[model samples]
Target: MALTVSIVQLAISVIAFPIFLLHFLGLWDRTCKKLFPYFMEQVTKSYNREMSAKKQELFSNLQDFAGSSGKVTLMEIGCGTGANFKFYPPGCRITCVDPNPNFEKFLIKSIAENQHLQFERFIVAPGEDMPQIADNSMDVVVCTLVLCSVEQQEKFIKEMYRVLRPGGAFYFMEHVAAEPSSWNFFWQQALKPTWQLMFDGCDLTRETWKALERGSFSKLNLQHLQAPLSWKIIRPHIVGYATK
Candidate 1:
């Protein structure tokens, strides 16, 4: 039985290795975006209703904070299909960056539909490397549910800091590993292999805020919440207003 299990594990790793490698090279975003609608449908169905409500509340709070600052300039990294479009303030200048070229069409459509909102531009680039925008230029940087899938979280945070103007805020919402619990830890470890295979290297056990701190933001305000589950697996979130 042990030998058989070893062989099976080896085979699974062999089959998934190429996909993982491609993910590291930034191919996964394109592939995932192509299938995003289908993925989202399944996720929407499976996600707990209360969890969704909490997320909505989080966005509401973020919007309120952003709105308080008059005519803020915003940059959203990994703005897949502009999921947070409705949360942006009406007169704010917004720039969205995503590697998916297909998102541009959706963005244009969203902009056209929402004539009241101010949109400055859309750039096709990975968050880790955004060359088009100058340093200390943007007033606010927003990232929602994107850190887990990024190839280099540390580098992305640094890039965000580099581009943000002095006193600019970095707002984020991410899913993370649960706290110390036997069952949750076990499940998280067990599922990581399969999850990485299917979900573009998004690990369920990453400490996202640690990576953000490494970026050297001046002020960091963070909030953490857990998923409603028996296990210690809190969807360990941190919503912070970090300064550059």
Candidate 2:
């Protein structure tokens, strides 16, 4: 029996090795990007409904960044699938940025569907380092459901501040880590490794506020609330704006 079990384990490892290597090389992410937008659409259906009210209130604070054009100049980092496009105020000129070029087509389609907002351009760049966007240039910066997956939390948060002009607003909504003593926190830590690997490196236990607090925003108005996500680990969310 022991010999048979050992042989079976070896066979399973041999079969899984190639797939593991492919994932390590990010071929899996490249392949999955084709379907991820569609998948996200399905997944956020109910989630979007629950959060719509809060989003409306958050976006209502849009300021006219375009002096005479009467348009808000906005930049969205990690603008996946243009999920927040509908929430933007009318006549806003939006520059969308994401590390993945695969998102461009999906964003184009999303922009087509939501004609209220103006599409400026889509740049393929990560949030932590976007040199094409000059320092203190953007009027408003938005990020939603993206903080958990960034490569460096502190660097990315600071980057958001750098690109925003003085007196600009940085709007953010993100699922965050649970309270330290809670049962959810235990599970968040336990499942994090596998979750990070499978979910494109989303860390369930990120204390996102720490980095945000360090960002040196002139005025930060952060609020913590439980979102209506079925996944308990991702239910704790923080949403608000920071003025630079």
Candidate 3:
């Protein structure tokens, strides 16, 4: 019986590994967009229900900090689909960077519809390689739920820090590993292989906030919220602002 189970597990892993590699390389985004409308629907639904609230709160707080500072230059790394468009401060000049070249059309169209919005630029580049933007030119840099998918979190954080002027803020919300518990630890260990496969190399067990804290931030205002589940098992979220 144990031998049969082992064979089944091996078979599952063999099937999943290639799919996971495709996801990591971003082939799944184009291939699955049509077949995965339900996936997109769930993403949109989750954004509208859970993520929108968080974005509004974080943006509002960041806006207040920006205060009378006129027309702040805002950079959003990994601004996929421009979903955070509605939450951007009025009169803010925006520049978006994403590794996917296909994201350009959506970003351009979104900006065109909003007359108040002005685009400084859009570059098809990773967060760690934003060469076009000058150093310390941005007032705000926003990253939302993107850290886990980044190949080098440390490099990304350093790039964010390098671009921001002193006193500039980094607003972010990211999913992270849960607190240590027997069941949670077990789930993290067991499900990570499969979870990373489907989710573009996103590891549920990454201590993303701890990594941020260790990075070169001047002021770190961090808060954590657990998702609706066994708190130690699934979807632990950390959201906050860090200053450079």
Best by lDDT: 2
Model 2 clash tally, residue pairs:
1
Q: If the candidates were sorted by their TM-score against the true structure, best first, what order would they fall in?
A: 2, 3, 1
Over 111-145, each residue of candidate 3 has an lDDT whose tens digit, in order, gives 88666767888888889888888898888999876
Clashing pairs in 3: none
Q: Please give the RMSD to the true structure for each candidate, in Å.
A: 4.8, 5.4, 4.4
lDDT values of the candidates? Answer: 0.71, 0.82, 0.74
The sequence of per-residue lDDT tens digits that candidate 2 reaches over residues 150-191 is: 989888878888988888899999998999888777667766
Q: Supply candidate 1's per-residue lDDT for 211.
A: 88
Question: What's the TM-score of every candidate structure?
Answer: 0.76, 0.87, 0.80
Model 3 bad stretches (over 4 Å): 1-42, 65-69, 112-115, 182-185, 228-234
Candidate 1 residues 1-244, lDDT tens each? 4454456556676778876787789997678767764564345334434355655665554344343456778899977656666666677788999876666776687678677678899999999999999998888888876888788898898898998888778888777876646456555665667576676457877789888777787778777876553334445666656766
TM-score: which is higher, 2 or 3? 2
Model 1: lowest-lDDT 10 consecutive positions? 41-50
